[model samples]
Target: MKAVCTVLIACVTMFLVPTAVAQDARRITPEQIDRLVKPYLDAKRINAISIGVIDGDVSLTHHLGTLSRDIPNPPTDQTIYEIGSISKVFTSLLLASEIEAGNLKLTSTVGELLPDVSKANPALNSVQLVQLATHTSGLPRMPANLDLSNVTDPYATYSRESLHTYLSSIDPAAKPGEKSEYSNLAVGLLGDVLAMRSGDDYDVLIRRVIAEPLGMTDTGAMLDPSCLSDSQKSRLAPPHDANLDANYNWHFASLAGAGSVFSTTSDMLRFAAASLDPPDNDLGKAMRLSQQKHAAPIGSGVAMGLGWHFARDKQTLWHNGQTGGYHTMLMVNPKLNAAVVVLCNTAMGDVDALAGQFIQTIAGMNVEPKSFDEALTVPAETVARLAGQYEIAPGAVLTVRADQSQLFAQLTGQPEVQIFAISETKWKYRVVEATIEFELPDSGPASSLTLFQSGMKVPGKRK
Candidate 1:
């Protein structure tokens, strides 16, 4: 009975509002921000919220909710949140900085870095470092050999040996630079490669070269176990589950570049600000270049930057992350000196979407991008006609149905999802971030539906 929606429909219909209208460059008023953000924070069992709204040279910061519901500890702008994959942008930038320093080259192969790189297997000795970083190396989401017993503590046991063995048998999904498929193993491996090449620790290199230079005091892989005082630990927000149980923590150190960076809203906002400005340090410019598109286009009007998702209409750059209990979002609107960073301690739904709505409101755009509900149409019979199993890719089947007044879909391997009818023909779902549109074909079939998400679309033939 529990379902996750596959696509987020807002980005497609949402248009940007010009921020040219000059307003006072003060922090966003609490009243103005509360009006826009209070709904989600209040409705969801959010543990804590830290939001930084930067406009012009001024930034308004808010610390809402509590670090723990049982205890009454309020969060401050200084409270750190584990910024997941956004760390990838930083790692990629480190690689770029190495490039600028003539210490590394983007074109260098992994084999070149570790010529004797046969840890768990032999074939891995030849993989390229760039391939792993950009995720064009045909790696899975994680190591193929990893059989995590505890889903919550999944990566706790993934070892370097096992990773090397998987790489030895690695069969690329796409060639070295064919397509963009996100791979934690790939990016993490790139981190190892960087460390191997530099003869310095990955964490130390990132800190000494990037974080310290940018004055991002709270941005790093792990907080000193000693630094977290008993009060601080007690004040730390625990991640939430649907049943309100305690969840697990994410491991980025073992898998370094993939997803392991912890940071606070203030630090992230500073990172975004520095990212928008040209790199004053060698690492900064390299970071910008890493976010620049490298391979063929993957999503609609979007391309894969070195490690981030590149979207254009107004050249908006964004990346979001979801670990077990946390959701993080960071976006930079370079055109406007404006950017939004939201960190929430909850596994509830699309926190990024919620945060983006607030950002949209702050930018004077229509905050509530509209979508359909199940009962909006009375013709379930017609919607049923559009229901059935659709095969979009090899070994992938998307099942659709019309129940009562709603149209629903479930990928063959996924649970059933109720699709919101955006229009009679177009439907949008959840964080999977795709769209399902029904169309009438003139000659082939009576009515057909096409699947569009990110940038890929496949039409369903009548079956």
Candidate 2:
């Protein structure tokens, strides 16, 4: 189930809204925001959702649902929520700022910053600062030695010592700048290295460089109780899981640079606004540099900037993040000078879809309701016959089981979700837009299945 909760950082551009329509598009009314978000929140059982829209000089925010089912507290623009990997953009901004100050260079190697790391893995000697920011450092998504003691707060105990130990033994899967692989380890190490060069801890450095300059008072790696007033603290939304149950907040002593920031919608929108039109200052220069495409385009028409990923086709820059109990999305269309922020208290909420719809609405694009095929009634015996384990990859298995009259698919390390049968062979998840097609042989039960989602299909063989 933990693997199921892993954030899928997919940035896709749907259809581009016309420039004329975008220019004429007015601010999104609270009523319209509710109409776009309420149905999904109700269907997913998400406790709270807050959205902020920035159209030119106007800012509009809408909040829906309570902070939690038990405590009927509505989240305001000031209510803090854990905004996971969105912190990466902040880290990249720090890198860009350092570069602007001539304190660091994009060509600076990891070996140059931390000799011990290079001594342990010479491959890291070739990993450049820009590679780390653009996710081209050849680092894995997570360290191979990451053995979590507590599932809820997985990164809480992973200290700087743990990071150094992992780096001392790990090897890169590819050459530096050879390919783009999303790596928390890479970015976290970048943050750590930047801190080393600046004589500050990751949190302190972020505040002094990005947060303070931008007037983002409520955004930080550590949200100090003293900094928040009693009312703002009361408005803080409790984290919730897919089932809307209370979930623990994540702590990342070493990996905080990767995804460990709590922020309010207003604070994040302010940051987003700064990104759209950076002021004439050192930090502003860094902001502009961060939006520059420093590397080749990653898959899905997404190009890597310093910290931001650009959707070239749609002419938008965006990033999204998910923690154990929360999901947040920030999208900015610099061309239209429009941005949308969606913050959800529940990890299961589809904030990405919500943000996409919000952007489309503000851009004056038609958004059609998504439709799914009717489920076909299959015999119990037939359903039972299809129940088996399929190998998605080495050490990864997709288990299909018949739960009474319903069929469910559970991938290894992922939560089990019921699949609706489109026919006898095709099935889809109700909550997410994904389909599974079983490959039935001529004379036996299905031996394999293909997963289709986001324009990619992956085949899995029955074990």
**Predicted structure with the largest TM-score when compared to the true one:** 2
TM-score, candidate number 2: 0.86
Question: Which is the leading candidate under lDDT?
Answer: 2
Estimate, for each residue in 1-463, the C-alpha lDDT of model 1 and write its tens digit: 0101112221222235454645542235567666666665554445677788777677777777776656567678777666666677777777778888888777877666655554543445545666676667666556656654455645546666666666766666656565555666777778767765677756677777778988887766632334344544544457654223466565644576666677777788778888778666676678777767666555433455666655444455666665556667777766666777888766444556656665566566645533323324636656666777767666557778878768777654333545666666677654335678886444332266788854557777555
Candidates' C-alpha lDDT:
0.62, 0.75
Identify the runs in model 1 with alpha carbons over 4 angstroms from their true place. 1-28, 117-128, 222-235, 242-245, 299-301, 369-463
Worst 10 residues of 2 by lDDT: 1-10
Model 2 residue runs over 4 Å out of place are 1-5, 8-15, 19-22, 222-233, 298-301, 312-314, 369-389, 393-435, 439-446
